[model samples]
Target: MDKETEQLIEKAGKVYSENFSMTTCFERAIFFSWWCGINDCGFCFMSALPKEKTAKETAIRHESSILAETWLCRKLGWEFGFFTGGINAFNADKIESMLEKINKVYGEKVWISLGPIPKKLLERYKPYVKGVVGSVETINEDVHKKACPSKPINPYLKMFETANEIGMKTAMTLIIGLGETKDDFDKLVNFIKKYHISKIHIYGLIPHKGTVYSDADIPSAEYQAWWIAKTRIEFPRIDIQCGIWSDRIERTSLLLKAGANSISKLPVFRKFGTKISYDLEEQTKLAGREFLGSLTKMPEIDFDEIDRFGFDEELTVKIKDKIKKYLNVMKKN
Candidate 1:
């Protein structure tokens, strides 16, 4: 590892030693996007689609990059790593081959956050992955369609459903501040409950300069805190995550207090010609929280026992009622 990465690991270890005992759900992990391809999702600002590469060439590059990231994750002592990128009609055979290679070489410590994937392809890829994330961004179909015109919400939902059915650890991401209302959030909570999703990543939109929603309003820290608290209460056992995009120290600290337990895509090493990102560790320190290493084992989830509001109907009603009351108060103020 380079000097910078070494220093980061040491600092993270110190933070972990100091804070791990006090927290119940404070874990951290890193992610890499091998092919930062062009996404038709109009809300993205960070996409840089490769123009000159062929499908086979792109597949090779992505596999090699993922292997390197796996090595870095192991060296840095992170317990989990993620493969993320834009939606492309990638060759299923090539993608599966790459995933199989990564699993064989690095073990099942990697997860993927690719957008919508076909059910057959997803099933073929399931055993090679630790988890699969199909981020719905928001539960409001209108907002979702408007934000991601090229990508429909139904396919994303199907991806999650299929992953769950295949016994693949499933996760989702919801972006706050995208014109979604409290009712939308409630719908998201209900969907997660219905699916028994293993993890949920909540991010506030960071309008990039080139994105269609560049001039969009950022959600308030207070609103984010409220949302996080609501999600925690609604899904008490699920791993709620905050990302580097929402890494302001005070804001992150508030999120932790509000029941967020993990931070994802922590920059441990530089790749894809981007600068080394270490905001997660710094944020953890500023939050005065422990930096628990990446996920070691999948949390045991009893899918059969998880009631789709049958067992927790009263709790669900109470939480939604509380959220409605709180939103009313905010509106009044």
Candidate 2:
């Protein structure tokens, strides 16, 4: 990691471990990731399409490991879920079989995160699953395309409509930074409000390895917090969470202060198949109260935990420097 990122992680540790020590929640939810087999979602490590692998090869190379890992996590008391790649590779029978096998192994813990597939397909799997997560990623269409080119053109609108019509509980995700303006944030919040989405997750862009967006810029800390705080003002009733809390705990707390009621806990998916390391339940225990207090039936969280490490000043300085470096490089290029 770079110097700036190291500083951020250090600050995150202090905030979560030293302050806001309270309840555990992120582990109570299922783990989901961008499982692409249709489109190589340039932002994820597992972006290889299923078609890119042969049928027997895919089943052998990919399926068994994931199945075994899911079963193991379930056995350890965590639900397992998968987000499909893209709508272009939509195959009903294939999905049904995958879920069927998942049910056989893990039973009633599977959640699909595909774009609005045909309604009939969703109806068929409704009985066997918990719920579907429609991670719009961002409500800004231009940003959406720029970030996830392989995604459907109007995924945000269409999926919002479908989730409402289907009456299935929905989890909508938003990625912050990505060069979106405050006006864009307002629009995204309104979109969420109109749909009455059950859960809304906010994520900051973590430019991944071996991707075009690897060098993409992250927003200013103040800007990120501003939008999140604004989101709290927009949807007070919905279950708002800062997705991937393990990625940045301070940011998670800021988003919670802004309006999100929860943080999507870490150990989201197993790396290199079926191996376990990060214990989300234990991590949650150490991750402070500002985050945990927002969960269902918990008392209103006091925002004092924000001061544990005096993070506001140091974090602001570090992020500003990083953002400036990125902007200068972008200009030069």
- Any runs in candidate 2 off by more than 4 Å, and if so which? 1-24, 27-42, 46-63, 79-90, 101-110, 220-223, 245-333
- Candidate 1: stretches off by over 4 Å: 1-38, 46-62, 79-81, 265-288, 293-333
Measured by TM-score, the strongest candidate is 1
Whole-structure CA lDDT of model 1: 0.58
Model 1 lDDT per residue over 1-333, tens place:
345433433444343334434342232332233344446555675343444556324433334345444433443345553566545535667667657655654556567777777788777887778788876787888888877776677877788788778878888888887789877767877888777787888878877677777889878666676667677665556677765453343466556656677654332232211222234444556656666542222222222322232324553344344434433433332
Clashing pairs in 1: 38-49
Per-residue lDDT for 239 in model 2? 55
**lDDT (Cα, 0-100) at 279 in candidate 2:** 34
Each model's lDDT comes to 0.58, 0.52
lDDT string, candidate 2, 180-231, tens digits: 7778966876776777776666667767666666788766545655555555
